[model samples]
Target: MAEKTTSTVPKGQKSQFAVPYYEISYDKFFQFGVSVDCVVFGYHENRLKILLIKRGAAPFMGMWALPGDLVYPNENIDVAAQRILRDLTGIDNLFMEQTKVYGQVDRHPAGRVITTGYYSLIDIAKHDPHASAWADGVYWMDLNEVPKLAFDHSDILKDALQILQQRVRHQPVGFELLPEKFALADLQALYEAILNESYDKANFRKRILSMNLLISLKENQKDVPHRPARLYKFDKQRYDELIAKGFSFEL
Candidate 1:
């Protein structure tokens, strides 16, 4: 005969049945936690920068790190990402794409926690970051000048950046970081900052103009040290139509 186990219901709770119960203990299952980290890339001063927050809590307190936090038990990963980013950085509603999962057994000092890295690009001048929650301060650091980061965030940033570079090369996602009206020089500089490479001025300008993805605004830079360059805006409507017809954007 199979042995029966006594029900371990709480004192205030009543058992549904009067017979002995057979319960499968869940204690033998592995317990772990999941978290989300955001790598927000922005273009500023003709350089690529990412948002970093100074930690105010333990397990790397006082160190600059990506805005991240533990995921709640009942929360979705994407929702957790948005919530965590808003709670720590005061920015919201930006589209973020998942990049990688860092699951080193000892990555987190607190416990066995796995973190998913998400990345997004934005116009730095548009969204102002305000640190809150466990973040003591928030700032943007140049990609090359980023100091050692907390936890395994450096690896996460690097992987996300690689994906960003690849995506930028194939898609027009870089426009998300540029002003609506911009000079070709501004566009080239943004690309260079992201790809970390320089292109011949004439060649780059000619290639971009030939694509017909830019609409001449008949406007020029108002105040500048150099000759005023004609401004153009990304022809997003045309781009969408072309993409529907199987046209791919290639840089």
Candidate 2:
């Protein structure tokens, strides 16, 4: 018999170069990469808060662990926890649901190609979810006190925070739901119901009106079963101007 030919090989490894290769169907389109991160927010004592943790390891060691990792890849359940809240309001795009994705393979030399972060709202005074072992000292940092975090997280957090700050006003379509002029009592009830908590009525009014986003019309609620309350309406001109200049009607 004739000897078989060798296309290529190491000096002594005759068969090493002969391995067959097969082309799999549609294998090129499988570049799908998915990751989930979250911005967990809560409200307590009229101050907005978010959950954060100190990194106890490298890549961002001693810095904040950010909203794109640390609570993902291993958190396989309880994501349904937010669904209850979602269904309660029957609203979509409630909070950062894949609203933005950081997709750049080289984003992390560590290995992920694509990433996404979701945001959720909660009552801060209630639960305390623990962070990963690599994350130490999990704390509810006041939104106003959020320190510089690791990675591009600061930008992500800032954007998500802005959405909620603005959304709380327009969502539940509150401003539109109110009549042109409304009583302070009705307005306070609107906020309390939406926020799922009570606010000190006097303080709530003071803080909300202090923004100067509302106009006190020279009118009062008419034909109410109770004492007539003052009336006010959202100032379209003022609201538009402040929003253009980065104003937030945080409740």
Using lDDT as the measure, the top candidate is 1
User: Model 1, 111: alpha-carbon shift in Å?
Assistant: 1.5
Identify the runs in model 1 with alpha carbons over 4 angstroms from their true place: 1-30, 241-251
lDDT for each residue of candidate 2 in 27-70, tens digit (9 for 90 to 100): 43354444544677765554567777677766777877454442
Top candidate on TM-score is: 1
Task: Give residue 217's error in model 1 in angstroms.
Answer: 3.0
**How much does each candidate deviate from the true structure in C-alpha RMSD?**
9.1, 13.4
Task: Evaluate model 1: give its TM-score.
Answer: 0.85
Model 1 per-residue lDDT tens digits across residues 157-224: 99999998887776664456778899999989988999898998898888888878899998999899
**Candidates' lDDT values, in order?**
0.86, 0.59
Q: In candidate 2, how many Å is residue 78 off?
A: 9.7
**Estimated TM-score per prediction?**
0.85, 0.48
Model 2, position 119, has a per-residue lDDT of: 72
Clashes (backbone N, CA, C under 3 Å), per candidate, total 0, 0
